[model samples]
Target: MARPSTAHLGVDLDKAGKQVGFISIPHSPHEDAWGAVRIPICVIRNGSGPTVILQGGNHGDEYEGPIVLGELIRDLDPATISGRLVILPAINLPAVLAGRRTSPVDGLNLNRTFPGDPAGTITQQISAFVSDVIFPIGDMFVDLHSGGSSLNILPSAIIEPAPDPAHRRRNVEAVLAFGAPLTVVIDNLGEPRTSTACAVRAGLTTVGTEMAGAGTVSLDALKICRQGVRNVLAHAGVLLPAAAAPAAREPEAILKIPGQAGFVFATADGVFEPCHPLGTMVRSGQEAGRIHHLADPSRPPETLRYGADGMVYGHRQPGRVVLGNCCAVVASPYEGSLD
Candidate 1:
């Protein structure tokens, strides 16, 4: 028997054996005044074995993952693969094209609206499509992300805790396969709307990765991310394992602090001169940076201090600062499992 033709939009997959194509999900209808758009999903499937997905551009500002995935798609050879590999380089195409953080039409953060409603906004419709069409088709999921906008996150993989111990083990194994220096295991803190959180809730092992800063793609970060993706494929038994390079050091557990504790912001608008750089260690109450009043030459710069003993993970880029803007983030050690 001949294979069935699976065609949607401009993507066609040969479903006879292993097919790779695009699936069009319904979007909000557009009137003559406003036209509806159809979201196209790129799917790569092998006839047999497990299915893995690589999604990027969830936050349009984070460009590394999408660029890396684009390169991977051009270079991938499905003949040697054992399972399905679905790569969606630009999940939020509108945001990516506009170079904005949120969808220009809806102004919604796609990441925060997973498992969304079909009748909701355009973002919700896309989320519903992913949940209905993509989630159940994959055995493993890898949602690629990076620090959006002003944040610069270290290259790391984040895995949410699975109820099943075996699934959790697999999740960790998959993250280890990425070969990133840092791996953070988190349990949803009542934030079940995230894609990773939803995947775990469905009993599927998922891995979330963050690489480089936002707004631009770093070549060094892209190289590391590509290697990580290859490593994941190899680890999942979809592709043959090649000689592995020297592994980076394992990451320490991340300690997420209470978001309600108002972050110390600049009291005066001026140039922010940091007393310490990123990755610096500080004790409780140690001075982190200083805010100099550029407008007044006579006033002394106000010293910024840490609230607890921890490592500096995030800080604002050196520039003119405004009053009431966050200065830096310190990562403190967690005494117990941070779930």
Candidate 2:
């Protein structure tokens, strides 16, 4: 069968039975300091069926997603599958190679620049590529992400509002298949800047999976993601394997906290001694943690307290705690939800 052509954005689909490759969606040249960066994509199709795009490395520091996508490409046997699979392991090449959160030149987040501008900044150019070249070709989508530098997030999936019940159910079910202990279903709270949300708005069943952390790879997390991808394929009938036994369902809940309620740090520079562990539940007035004068143990420790009751979702890693830096994140139930 002949592949479809997209002339508007210089995209062409090259297919071999169930395997298809998208070639040469041009990106704006990187700044002089960063050298040139090109965006490349490949699509694999298995006979005739639904199309799915699996993307990773939206944030340059998230390693697990890109690694897992690499493994998927290597292990995938197109002749054995039923539909098409588009794999983009490095969506933000410059950011990925630079090991930074955003493009070094633009200093803008690629993830937040989705549905991009054709005549905008470098980040906007990449966003336009995804919006024009990628989103239109898929029936379902999975975007992979992780904690950027200096943060460790428990593996979870983010499911935004679905346009319909069927898509919503599939979104949740697909997330659960990833076997992450936590699954956060967010309304996105008007953050339309996200790729997944953009895809969802475009009427695609999209979900974002969060694995490992900051520029580091965890083999265990990779395994979980790998299995999760396969499970999603099986669920979608792209792969003919039986679904794996389900993992224990973690207590599912939404977190609510004031928009202003995040990690509160001390004004003076000092050594931080956290009084709480990750996932600790705290009340509004409870001391979440503290900072102390490194040289004077006698001096009073600066107390950090929450403005609301909730569980800690994340905390500052061992390092200098700067003023205005978030030291902890408290997750409460859905009444005052950000989602």
Candidate 3:
């Protein structure tokens, strides 16, 4: 069994009104012996209903989520919603402050530190609190994410296909209701330590996003996230349904990433030259991009190819890349429904 978490909430989670406070995690670093890292948290409860946990800043560089969630926290009236909305706009405060993917304090990626250890590092402790405490109160989990500083991704709702048919259907419904430009069904992306994985293990209806990313927030992506979150909340019965917009439409496409094969990695360190933009369809073994050996003008550029036939879902944002870095990811059209 895991150790009990040392984290504590500053506000009452069970209260009947809007409460905003911090999740104070005890951190005794070199500078301070009794210091605590206070993560921003807000709980909005009307009457008794299901609880939805909304998280952002899982990866610090992703700004779209934090921006949208923050807006929701400030603008959303507690009276308009039932149940609760537990908001964590900047979950990884250290990373968000540094504007990096991983925590500056522990150098660990918060996303991969799920089901965390209470007796471990700061990042692990935060994860442990979420897994052991917060998840138990949540009927659904919505983790908002973008490509962060690494890649540019098409705006899409992402989910891992659950083993149980009924559970899988609910997830599908939530994703479709989110109504992003695309719906991506990826089986944990070959890493099961993510927030989505932890929430799934805890039996919460989990949904994530891969909105526009390239180290900067996009206005279009923000618009998509804002509306998508509201739609999901309404679908979960936490909030009353909003008036349908005149431009409302179903998701533009549904795609699936075939395990690890869907991702194309850099084989050597060099400047990447992408051959196609996001959403371009290509066949297996097609040239996805090349790594130019800028240092050695005489050396031939290392050509990279797609591992499968699919649309380009994402690619590295930075011009330079190292071996094993994900250069591109492809997702095939999902013909069958998760249901």
Candidate 4:
């Protein structure tokens, strides 16, 4: 059954200039019967032009996106743009506040719940509101992320070729404009419920990133996050070029990760020891990592290896792993732009 959408924002999105408010998801808990979960949002409009939706903190543990978007929320003004820019610094408030990958209220991964339910869990309701209400207003959508608390990454962007050729082309252009040090084309891994997948289905040019992680943020990661977002804004014509826009990521290497072969998973619960670091180029069948049985120190470790020749782009975090956990991901050789 199609549940009635209950999420609402406290601000008027149609108004011009900068407006600050919150998307209030009604919550009737034991403490506050009528209190709502407020997700901070900023809508900056200058006349009438393309609408770009910038979303960050999709995963609560990812810090770079939230940090940079918070800066934009506080510092960005209305006079600098030609179109509309809607920014959500911490979209998943419960997860962000709890410092986890899933929402504390519902224990659901926001990324996995797209085209959401109105009368479902709190997280699902938020996703439904965004997908049903806010997404239609966007001409382009950019979502930023990293490895979050569970992994470390190589400051890369993920660009999936949309089923529509036009959408695919536009998305690819947006990803290039993002200009991350490394951009990749990957299949959606058969998951069509992700933010990227949902945006693509909506025919919106979408771009997302997996910049850096280890349950923390970094100065370099912030710089990359800030620059990439600005570049996309400039490219989408939402932000006019400054005296000099942020530097483009030169010498970028584009790779493709097609299907499950690109990933390395832990077969048993153990400590993962990686043989190669992120950004390392390795040949097929190479030793990617090994899982050691810390519980039984005398037992020999079970080795893990790569399935193909590619560049290592992501790895599990904290050197720990559980059975069936993804330990690493590799991408194929560069086939796109250089600078």
Each prediction's TM-score against the native?
0.81, 0.82, 0.95, 0.94
Q: In model 3, which runs have C-alpha deviations exceeding 4 angstroms?
A: 1-3, 243-252, 335-337
Q: Residue 319 deviation, candidate 3, in Å?
A: 0.4
Which pairs clash inside model 2?
18-45, 18-46, 19-44, 19-45, 20-43, 20-44, 20-45, 21-43, 263-327
lDDT for 78 (candidate 2):
81
Ten-residue segment with the worst summed lDDT in candidate 4? Answer: 243-252
Q: Show model 2 residue runs off by greater than 4 Å.
A: 1-14, 17-36, 163-166, 187-189, 243-271, 292-300, 333-339
The deviation in Å at residue 167 for candidate 1 is 3.2
* Candidates ranked, most accurate by lDDT first: 3, 4, 2, 1
Per-residue lDDT of 143 in model 4 = 92
How far in Å is the alpha carbon of 38 misplaced in model 3?
0.5
**For candidate 2, lDDT tens digit of each residue in 1-339?**
112322133234446543333334334453344333555466677677888888987888888888888877777778877888888888887789888889875898998898887666767777776777678878889898877776666666666667677777667666666566566655545588889888987778777776757457877678778777777777667877664445455335534344455445555667666677767778887887777787887889788787777777666664567776667666666553222
lDDT by residue (1-339, candidate 4, tens digit) is 234677777888889988989999999878898999999999999976899999998999999999988888888888888899889989999999999999988889999999888888888888888888888889999999999989888887778667666777788778888867888876657787788788888889899998789898877888888888988898888887662255454323568874688889998988999998788998778899999998899999989989878889889997778888989988886564322
- Highest lDDT, which number? 3
User: Between the candidate structures 1 and 4, which one is better when assessed by TM-score?
Assistant: 4
Which window of ten consecutive residues has the lowest lDDT sum in model 3? Answer: 243-252
Residue pairs whose backbone atoms clash in candidate 1: 30-35, 30-36
Q: Pick by TM-score: which candidate is best?
A: 3
For model 4, what is the alpha-carbon lDDT of residue 5?
Answer: 72
Which digits, one per residue and each the tens of the lDDT, describe model 1 over residues 171-287?
877887788766655443557788888777766778888786745676777887888888887877777677244354433454433342314467778887767766677776777
